[model samples]
Structures are given as C-alpha cells and as structure tokens.
Target: MFKNIYFVCFILILSSCGKDPLPKPSGELRLEYPAHKYQSFNSDCAYSFDYSTFAEMQNAKQSCWFYINYPKMKAKIFLTYFPIHNDFALHVKEAEKLVYEHTIKASSIDTKSFSYPEKKVYGNFYELQGPTASNVQFYVTDSTKHFVTANLYFNSRPKPDSLAPAVEYIKKDMLHLIDTFKWK
Candidate 1:
C-alpha cells in the first residue's frame, strides 16, 4: 500500500512539473519591402514610363502591351495599349467598366483623377478596398492618339490585412509611374 501511495505521489509531482497550458499570443506578420528603384521603359509604342527594377517586363501578345511581374510578391501589373482613332470615349468607358465589375466583391472604390495638360496625360486611378480580386486599376490617355489601361493582380487570394504591406509598397511605385508618364 505504501509503495503504491509513493508511486501515486511521484506521478502527481511529475505532472505538476509542467507549466499551465496557455493560449498563444496573437501576432501580426511583419513584411519588409526593398527600397524603390526605377528604370525608364522605352518601346516602339506611343508612350513611355518609369518602371521598377524589382519587376520583370514581359512582352504581351499585342504590340505595346506588357506585364510588370513581381515574382517575389506573386503580383503583376498588366498594361494594355490602344491607339485612339476617335475612340477615346469608348476606351475610357471600357476601362471604367472593368473597374466597376469588381464592385460586387469590393467594399468601396475610390477614384482619383489625374491631369497633366502639358504632358497630355489624363485619366482616373481606381483604388478598390476589401477582398476584391484586384486592388488597383487606372487608365491614362492623351485624349487623341494613345490610351493605356493598367490593372494590378495577385496570384493568391487577397486578404487585405496580410497584403497591406505589399499593396502599399506597390501603390507608391505605381503612383510614381503615373506621375512620370510621358506620351511619345
């Protein structure tokens, strides 16, 4: 009986040696983005803009159409070019339609108009919030000869909370591109 009692006490002491079970503390992931560096993208197309060195440029099937692919982020900026042969309004409408299509999943969309009279660049920048498949879209044109539309897409499902850092980093780069855009 004494031996069994000592065994029980030993087991009890051994069990008590472990610390109390505790839930893990909640934490957010920390994402780091590299410093921004840009290079001039020159093509035989109607326009030229500065693109990030971090992104790889791929030739699209159509002339003047290209993709700025970020392999590390698994994101891409698609650029489509159309020559405006008295179809400026149509091109603008088409670009707007594409952005509006995301309204079903987007919580909100904010539009910013860009105008550079000297450069002849005019367009709207759309920033979509929530779980929309695309977070940003924009269209720029000289309103006479060249119309270009751009969209940013990620390969993975968009969880804004997780993608916030990458999104913000890319956002600045995109804005830089838009600001420096020149019609050739």
Candidate 2:
C-alpha cells in the first residue's frame, strides 16, 4: 500500500512537468481614445478659434479667461485672453516665466514656433516632459492687439507614464486651435 501511494504521487508530479511554468509576461496598461472632432468657437472676445467639441467650455473667474474641460480625462486647458495695448512684451515675458518655472520637475522642454502671417498669428508652443504641474504651455498673439496664453493641467498629480496618452490627445487639439486661430 505505501509503495502504491508513493508511485501515484510520483506520477502526479511528473504529469505536471511537461512545460516549464513561464512567469506570465509582464502586462502593460492599454488605453483607448475616441476619434477627435472640432467645432468653431467664436465670441465677442479678442480671439476666435476651433476647439475640441469633446471638451466643455466653462467660464473662468475672468470674463475673457475660460477653461476647456476634458471631464473624461480629468484635464483642463486654461485659456486667458489679453487685449494688448502696448503691453505685449509684458505678456510674453510672463508666459515664458510660467513655462520656465516648471523646470524644477520637467526633465526637458521642447518648443515649436508657429506663424500664420496671413492671419497675423504667431507664437511659441512649449511641451514640457516630466512629472510637472503643467505639462504644456503656449502664448498666441497677433503681436499687436490680442494675446492669448494657454496651459494644460490634469486634475490628479502628474504621472508622465500614465498621462502620456491624454497629453498627446490634448496637444493635437491645442495645435488645431492654433492653426485655426484668428483675431476679430
């Protein structure tokens, strides 16, 4: 009886040994985003542009300052409009200052300048890479009468790895706005 029991145990162990157990391959988080679309946004303010229809526009504390909220992604693009009256330099300086302030946490920053001379639109767009409060910033202006500065922020703490997708999606939207931007 003891021999029979030992033989059965041996067979069971052997049967389980056909394949080496592979450590299950590490898993990566998969995120899916919807196809983006935009609509024209124009007001009596100094600026007009196309904005993502996916985001809801909310009035901010100031009249011309408002937020484009992405509720699904828990992000917001805060936009401020300033009517330049010989203070264009001041606004530009402040925008650059705000972008530089994130240097402490930003591993790197890349900038791309855009201009539509026909539209009198020109500005620098900054993409901040790292775990920072604001990962994107830009100031658009006609260089004379209208200056608009925008910042992208997530409601939660910045996690570059997890937030990469959202950042990219919103970045495209920002670019669209810049492309279609004009002053009335």
Candidate 3:
C-alpha cells in the first residue's frame, strides 16, 4: 500500500509540474508596405495617369483596357475604357451598378465625388466595407467622349479586418491615380 501511495504521489508531482493552461490574448495582424513610387502610364489610350512602380500595368483583353497588378498583395485593379457615344449617363449607371452589386455582402458603402475641371476629369469613388468581392471602385470621364471604370479585387477571401491595411494601401494608390488623371 505504501508503494502504491508513493507511485500515486510521483504521478501527481509529475503532472503538477506543468504550468496552468491559459488562453492566449487575441492580436491583430501587422502588415508592412514599401514606400510609394509612381510613374506616368502612357499608352495609345486617350487618357493618362500615374501608377505605382510596385505594380505592373498590363493590357486587358479589350482595347484601351488595362490591369494594374499587385502580385505581392495578390490583388489587381481592373480598368476598362469606353468611348462614350452619347452614353455618359449609361456608363455612370453601370459603374454604380457594379458597386451596388456588393451591397448584399458589404457592411457599408461610401461615395466620394471628384472633379478636376481644368483637366476635364470627373468621377465618383466608392469604398465598400465588408467581405465583399471588391472593396474599392470608381468611374471617371470627360463627360463628352471618354469614360473609364475601375475595380479593386483580391485573390483570397476578404476578411475586412485582416485586409484593411492592404485595402487602404491600394485605395491610396487608386486615389493618387484619380488625382493625377487627365484626359488627352
């Protein structure tokens, strides 16, 4: 009985050596981005703007369309060009449609209108908050002949909390593009 009692005591001592279980404190993810460097994007298209050197500009399937690809962030900004033929309102409607399509999944949506009458650039920027397929979208035009629409999409599932940094980074770049936009 003494031997059995000693055996139980040893087992108890060994098991008690471990620290008490504790729950880990939750933490937010930290993401880092490089300094922003931009260069003017020139093409046969009628409009021009500056884009980040961190991204690659590729020609899209359609004429005058382009994709600014951020391989590091696994995201892409798709830009589509349309020569307005008395359809400026139609193009604006289409851009609003694309942004509103995510309403079902988006927690909230904000719209900002911008115009550079000197450059003849006018547009609305839409920022959607949530796990939607797109977080930022916009449309720009000269209100006479040229129209362009853009959407920012990520390759992976969007957890707004996790993607907030990347979204803000790209959103700033997009805003820069809009600010420098000019219709030629």
Highest-TM-score candidate: 3
* Candidate 1 segments whose C-alpha is farther than 4 A from its true place: 1-28
Return the clash pairs for model 3, or none.
none
Q: Tell me the TM-score of model 3.
A: 0.86
RMSD of 2: 4.0
Count of clashes, each model: 0, 0, 0
Give a tens-digit lDDT track for model 3, residues 1-184: 9999999999999988877799998886697999888999988899999999989999889999999999999999999999999888999899999999999999999999998999999999999998999999999999999999999999989889888999999999999999999888
Over 1-184, each residue of candidate 2 has an lDDT whose tens digit, in order, gives: 9999999999999898877677987655777778889998877787888999889998999888989999988999999988889988999999999999999999999999998999999999999999999988999999988899999999998889889989999999999999999888
Ranking of predictions according to lDDT? 3, 1, 2
What would you estimate as the lDDT of candidate 1? Answer: 0.93
Model 1, 51-108: lDDT tens per residue?
9988999999999999999999999999999998988889999999999999999999
Better of 1 and 2 by TM-score: 1
- As a whole number from 0 to 100, the lDDT of residue 66 in candidate 1 is 98
What would you estimate as the lDDT of candidate 2?
A: 0.92
Alpha-carbon runs more than 4 Å astray in model 3: 1-29
| Cα-based TM-score, every candidate | 0.86, 0.85, 0.86
